[model samples]
Target: MKFKFSIIFSFFLYITYGQINVKGKVVSKSNQPLEGAAVFFNSTTIATITDENGEYQLTVPEGKYKLVASYLGFKTVEREVDINENTSLDRLNFTLEEEDSLLNEVVIGAKKKTKSKKPKYEDFLVFKEAFLGRTNYAEKCKIDNQKALKYYFDPATNTFSVEAKEPIIIINRDLGYKITYNLEKFQIKDRIISYFGYSQYEELEGSKRKKKKWKKNRKKAYHGSLRHFLKTFITANTKEEGFDINIMHRVRNEKHPSDSELAFSKKIFEFQDKRSVPINFNKVIVKPESKLDSAILIHQRQLKHPKIIDKLIKRNVSYSDISYRVEGKVYLKFDGFLKVTYNNEPEEFNYKRDIKRRLGVQKSNFLLFDSPQEILPIGQIADQNNRLVEGYWSYELFANALPLNYKPPKE
Candidate 1:
């Protein structure tokens, strides 16, 4: 009798100490078992991952508890249940619904029509018009660069080049010691090609003499900076904000334009300031229409490359019809550039002057010179030969002349 009582007590203690098996299967709304689902009790105490069969088990004290089932891409589900000391739970199950990606859909029961929303003209047009004129100047100029090494194989040779990147913008001209690396400081190579593209203009014959004359008459130069030239050209030619059909896209079976026809067509639509406009136009009529059998997308992606136009030309891109995608971030303005290359090489010396709109002092004003000149002050070199040598640092200029506190021109 004593032995039987001890055995019964031992059995009772074993039953009390044993854990309550909390078993369940987590599944999605589609009734498919979620293999990597997580199951937890009271959000923390007991946690377990679902098996390949979406079944999970957690040994917990026989008490009331909350169970949570979670999986990626699905809404979490929770349940409250009671557990007894000697109870076995039946097939516990969880059903999770896929999380709706668009938040508005959950509250409204359906996605609202986003197509009806007004199109943002500032996203595409304003910057396009502002920078396209630079495209024009670049296309007209003969891009050429010659390395001016005063002495060969000498440390003091003063190696430099002379050329303006496609756009004759002062910022695009680069002349100086091509510092390739720096140990203590982060070495930077001035990248200026961000400004110009294959422009819509003819190469001027006898450009060398013309450039010389322009340099001699710096004060009387028609455009103060390449910026001014481009801004003027873009504003003068483009009356409306629309894609230029000729330069941007190749129309097929369309009304063939006459030789005197304007390549750029003004869109009749007028956009209001701070007001959204609808994007409505045939794809073919879009400024940047993709060619059926071309790599325009590839080229646009690689536009950040220094020699993009050269690469595009190598890939059979037509100089006249190379599409200029006006897609860019908000009004990109560069402080200045250290290097400007044309015809695939760096320029030696160039100079461009910018007037401080408020001060308007012609002399003793900010003279935007090459970075080399900026580092080596020309005034300090007093000797004639030394001054000449220091002054020999020629610079090309690609600048946008703007009045201080410039407001957008009235259309």
Candidate 2:
């Protein structure tokens, strides 16, 4: 959780910008123009409504964006477009199909159980604060339509979940980006919140001054971010990147899981016919309550936060460092938690932005980001399961996100 912003904080002067025009229209599957449709580029604030003739125009910065066409009771259409200085005659047209239904809710009970009480207005607010994020900049984000979201809370498991049929349109005023999120799953349990979905972003239009401010804010937001760390990790520049990583091997306590984990371990053990075999839940299941729970526990305290633990039984296991393949895909090969810390002292570069708030305590072995391996080895990363508690990384949310096409400038 303790990470430096110095190395990753510099402004990305290499980012491109230019006012580009994108014209388009939304129509029905039968080719009839659909008026009043919501049309906008994903991840940007630049948006407009379709005119009576189903025509629309969006002026935005030059970059790759996902064009989204949506209308009430119609399936949203999304298209990717690259708008650059050389690009000409860029037209984004869409033919949307009517939605079968707007009611998109999931029921987990085997039988059709009675519905839970409707979520209160306050409940929705809490959900928004958690989902959109609690960062200071996250306050600028707004969900265009809240009614589009459906919430369900189960008392039996004390769990809360959400769903949406259409992609949730989120406009970030601070970042000047529009995000269209197709929420697949979201749930809150055990004081932890976890959700997964695909999303696309579009650049929103801003004045010269606002753009300058956004550029500065983005640099601060991007520093010490998951993406930034990953970029540095792949290149084996931890020290240069202001990160100190101390890896340790897994030492299973002679004791088994504590009372509850042990009980859950029994459930999995009995399911496996009492075999003393290592189970591969996501290849590394740290939480007994994890949806992918498949094995018994070796030590109840194995996943404790790295900052709180001292005198770790350092493992001498050898493995390749996190690096990239010939094709440039990052690959991770490790055995234990990479307890990382921000070695660089905080600089007075931006006194206002550096002021510490309730960013939560520094934790270790935390997964920086999701990779192809849906499940990570618990031994390799602390808090591999449960609600993945992010330290300062939580502050660096989607607002600071950049596309894969971005390549950092040479130092």
Candidate 3:
């Protein structure tokens, strides 16, 4: 699971107060000024370059952010900043150390020997789909550096993993943004995929008409999205934002036989049917040879009657139903699954066909892996790993991602 950094922006401060000025200096370990060092907040476009004096400044809204300073041939430095009414902005400074290039070279050399074999075409396809996702915008998104990716497959566990030697450059013509993604980790196992990365977006140059089209497309992508849902949910405006919330209870099927019972039954069937007799088995006592057979049988039964939502606990849920306040901080807590329905927009054709939902409404399922997730004022979950999502939200991946600083146009 990706670690989601939750940033709580002071919406009240943003609307009525002036921006905060953040000034900082970047110096080497030897106290030498580092010129042309890029200083910015991770995953946002709020950035500046250090001058000859290694001084950089930025005016930003009050919020919690991961500030980063990067220069070529030096290790990047990151600091967590909380800019509020009492923050002393001038204290924000960074001292970077030189990176060990020789160690890096040795590691790269060893990796090359072990992973010299080229990846199969089919493997690349799987990697692409899992990383880029299957949204409409993903169709127009292209990864510019395929060679930078290294692939490994473990047939024993049926796991596929990928790593990038450098930042992956992606050009999204539809959204009019060129993105640089620093992929940290990516893996696919047991039909579950997880990838963590930081992204920086640069606006693409285009004609006036083309720019207008991109703006419209970006807005379309933002609506009915997870971010939009979170913003509305925190503001207690789900209904106004065309969202309907419901509590769904998933129960295990009682009719499903236990693994031991299945194993006993399988032994009986094999003995009675005289199918594949064991080498040293007697008629009085028959035992399964390995766990693999039992696992396969259990999996087959689960497919027939998997754990399913048996009931709806409530409908038209309000924000208070799933949230609580402690010392002025908000946290979302709920039982079972959260069934979210977006009524304003109909389901896409691909989604409908693949998910096999005939209803035109857009519906998604939200499950809490870790309960009582903190909710920031900016509509971001403080801990991203705490929640698991399926359906519509799961379909929208990096292709539909927007910067944390993205703001919807005023209605």
Candidate 4:
């Protein structure tokens, strides 16, 4: 009887010790206080956004809780913790990995155009038009100024460039900006004449290409006639309006053994596709929490890096021409302003507030800044107002020409 009573008492003690307050300060990789970091456990609404000091306080009934910490432009962190009563995890800090804005860089042959086949220049121009046309998509109505930038495509090198006129990133959902352009935009420089060498894409039917790959994959081709139609659709019309965007996403949780976890333990994503349609992934989805609202998920991802490249191409901002070779990718020059929090003294410019002003001016028909030549001017304007406007002035050309037979191997 005595032994049983002792055992029961110990169990009660263990239960009592499990409850506690978990307190911590969330800082960025640079040791900067991460204000507004979302500290939550699992999918529960039991959550709190970090304070201006990058500090948070949470009460948990000890067990294993999936602790997620996130901020804009930063990677999302999911951690497991077992707490005890009266335990104060003071300085329990979270570090977020910075995101690489550049997507993929490839190189393709920059060959001359020939008459027997479609000139490489014509394909390049078609690609350019499809890329630029994406900017005009209706999604622009939902743009957020702070996260928005003008993307330029260089025709000669097939590089994508970026330029920012404003410094603030708006956090509203309908107003939040997207990361990549809906499609690629091509800029034309000097015309290059070349014959089509390979018929890589000639096999795909037009309708098949138009349909989402996932959808087509799920529903296999039924009739030979349908398959034939697909082939014709993709190849029949060289003059057909061409545009496509393909974005692949993977969401992993360590608890879920089937899916592999990411190395360095942060969210990693890459969006690259060679389709000829304007696919803005603006309404994109991220996994495990895909069911969760995007505003919340994307907002959490933003903590690491506040500056996200606008994938939407703006003809007014992009280079006048662009073309790609098979297996080639290019990086072009960009200039823009970055908004940083003031840990020391408040810089004269408040990026969050200034973004609105910049947007307002643009709406009022004010030319806020120019490109290449005006890049310096935009930064000067932001600096004059006491804000940070770092220029993205240079980039490398990964590939000037991409092969017609572009196929991304299965992951």
Error of 3 at 25 (Å): 3.2
Candidate 4: minimum summed lDDT over ten consecutive residues — where? 1-10
* Candidate 4 residue spans exceeding 4 A from truth: 1-19, 86-88, 103-411
Give the per-residue lDDT of model 3 (tens digit) for 333-383.
999878999899887765654564485888887777788887766566766
Candidate 2 C-alpha lDDT tens digits along 1-411? 232211111111112467778787789989899998888654334678899999998887675555677776787677766677776634578999986663533347763223337656766785685576556577788889777777777777887777776778888777666777666566676666666544556777889998887666666555555555545644556567666555654454534345566566657656666556555533555555752253323322344322233334343222235433545334554444455555443422222243445322232344333432221111112122322323454434444455333344444
Residue runs of model 3 more than 4 Å from their true location after superposition: 1-17, 27-36, 51-54, 71-76, 97-121, 154-158, 265-303, 307-310, 326-328, 352-354
Q: Give the clashing residue pairs of candidate 3, or none.
A: none
Which is the winner by lDDT between candidate 1 and candidate 4? 4
Worst 10 residues of 2 by lDDT: 5-14
Better of 2 and 3 by TM-score: 3
Q: Give the poorly placed runs of model 1, Cα more than 4 Å off.
A: 1-18, 104-411
* Candidate 4 per-residue lDDT over residues 1-411, each given as its tens digit: 000000000000011225467788788888898898777664232457789989999765654444667665665666656555434467566887764554323223553222113354554344333222122122232323423444444445643333333222221112111221111212232331111110010122335444355233222211111112112222332112121211112233323222122221123332212333233334445564532233334434444333323232332221212111123222112333211111211212212232323321011011113322211100112111221112100000111111111222322
TM-score of each: 0.23, 0.56, 0.79, 0.24
Model 4 TM: 0.24
Estimate the lDDT of model 3: 0.72
Ranking by lDDT: 3, 2, 4, 1
Better of 3 and 4 by TM-score: 3
Q: Which candidate's lDDT is highest?
A: 3
